[model samples]
Target: MTRNLILGALLSSLVLLLAAVSFIWTPFDHAAMNIPAKLQTPSAQHWLGTDHFGRDLMSMIMVGARTSIAVALVAVGIGMGAGVPLGLAAAARKGSWLDELIMRGNDLVFAFPSLVIAILITAVLGAGAVNAIIAIGIFNIPVFARITRGAALSLWEREFILAARVAGKGAARISAEHILPNVMNLLIVQGTIQFSLGILAEAGLSYVGLGAQPPTPSWGRMLAD
Candidate 1:
């Protein structure tokens, strides 16, 4: 990886590590409010000072990172698992009714912003992490589906794909063995792109009171406050 990529990765990893550590041990109880120490500047006692609520800012921030990371990871997982298969299937059956249906469905999903969809889902499901994950994950589906379908379609015409068909390989077999392997790099790039988006989505949802419920620090909620 490039130096920039390495640095970004390290920083991201470090934040996640600190967040995990905070779950087990924060210098002060994150939820405990101390009016006496409220709004104090960063000092030996409170490294990042206290918030308006007198809660430890650093502790709250660490927990927020953990919540954001967890939501994003799960949301992306849902997208990749469901979207990749849909894309591959659509590509394998190119020109068929199935392809049209899938792409049309993707377009429909793409029409709405994830945050809007999340708000709707939260309204129904009563606003929580699981509901937020479902909302964001559903949104990611179309994005990955489009990327996978486009990349997989190109691979479908490759030499190996034709050879696989000639060798009596079924559509599923060819897609799994030949097409998937070749398009993985593209998928990886798409995945990286989507992950950042997922984090942002989680933040947005939390800000709107539709994600990561109370007692769980959320970056978006903190910002909204």
Candidate 2:
């Protein structure tokens, strides 16, 4: 299982590698249309053939990869940034009103469907990459909140954590100095998982015209059309 996870990570990294490399070079321009070459089969020149619009398919895939990676990274970053702190606070406070407030807020956010939330956000904010990022990022917040809270709950009971409490440490300070450091690894693993989910969600949004907008050559948009 661990070997499989490692292999999956490597394969995923390769897609990002190609996408980053695409910034420097692609076999053909992704935007330029070749009407005469429309729908051409894969060949030495067009490795993945051409789309119905005569855009080089391979180029589209490479460029699309960039958008996917960017959206996922930003969305996951937002989740981690906001969720981790909320979760740590909840754990540190334990039975306090702050814990209940944070957790109940998370539950409320989680109650909404992700797709509906994205659509609503895009509708209000206007459909584009920025809105899509915000939508996906918002959806991820509750997920990380739950994960972080669960993980932090256990760590809060550890000897080190208790010692920090006994050492005249404030809740916020102890959480920052102790809890965060302890759960950093867990957060990273969760980040990677959320990153993948964000990519899929971004694609779904794009497929429905709520993501990166036209001319961006998103993978979901490509698949949609």
Candidate 3:
């Protein structure tokens, strides 16, 4: 596990460095095309070769890393920001109508896969990075909500939570002060999982022509090309 963790971190950091460097420099313009040079094999001039349009694959991969990172990071942020609160609310409320409502809503969302959600969103929003983000983020919401609520529920029955309640804390205060901290580790683990899923979701959307448009490099679109 430790070895895997280190390897994952190293790979993730490498991708991040590549994306950051791409903002400043790349071997060639990702959007520029030389039809004559198209489909060339790897060489010193084009480390990863060139696409059919002669755009540098290495440059495209670098820029696409940036797009994938941005979409996944923002989508995870949106999921945690919105879903955590809803989950906390549901947990605090327990068996109340609010809890039922929130869980049911999560279930409803879970019924639709991210791809289906992306398709529905793109059908209306006309396919773009923003729409892809929305679709992935929306799917992430239910996942985090369910995880948070489950973890929070377990914590609510703990001695610390009971003590907080005994100190005259209300449901919201007890939840904020006592419950949230206990479940943070679980949330972090789940967030990492969701972040990976966000990347796949973005790629799938792009593959289907519902993600970042042309002139923008995307792994999925590159594969499609």
Tens-digit lDDT string for candidate 3 (101-134): 9999999987877678877887788889998888
Q: RMSD, model 3, all Cα superposed?
A: 1.2
Candidate 1: worst-modelled 10 consecutive residues by lDDT? 113-122
| lDDT for each residue of candidate 2 in 1-225, tens digit (9 for 90 to 100) | 999989998998899888999999999889999888999999999999998889999999999999999999999998888888888888878889998998899888878887788889988999888888998898888788778888889988899888988888988898788878878898898898888888898899899888898789788899997
- Which pairs in model 2 have colliding backbones? none
- Displacement of the residue 122 alpha carbon in candidate 1, Å: 1.9
* Residue 131 CA displacement from its true place in model 3, Å: 1.0
lDDT of 1 at 54: 87
TM-score of each: 0.93, 0.94, 0.96
Taking the tens digit of each residue's C-alpha lDDT, what string does model 1 give over 92-135?
99989999999999998878876788778778988888988888
Ranking by lDDT: 3, 2, 1
Note the clash tally of each candidate: 0, 0, 0
For each candidate, what is the lDDT? 0.86, 0.88, 0.90
Worst 10 residues of 2 by lDDT: 174-183
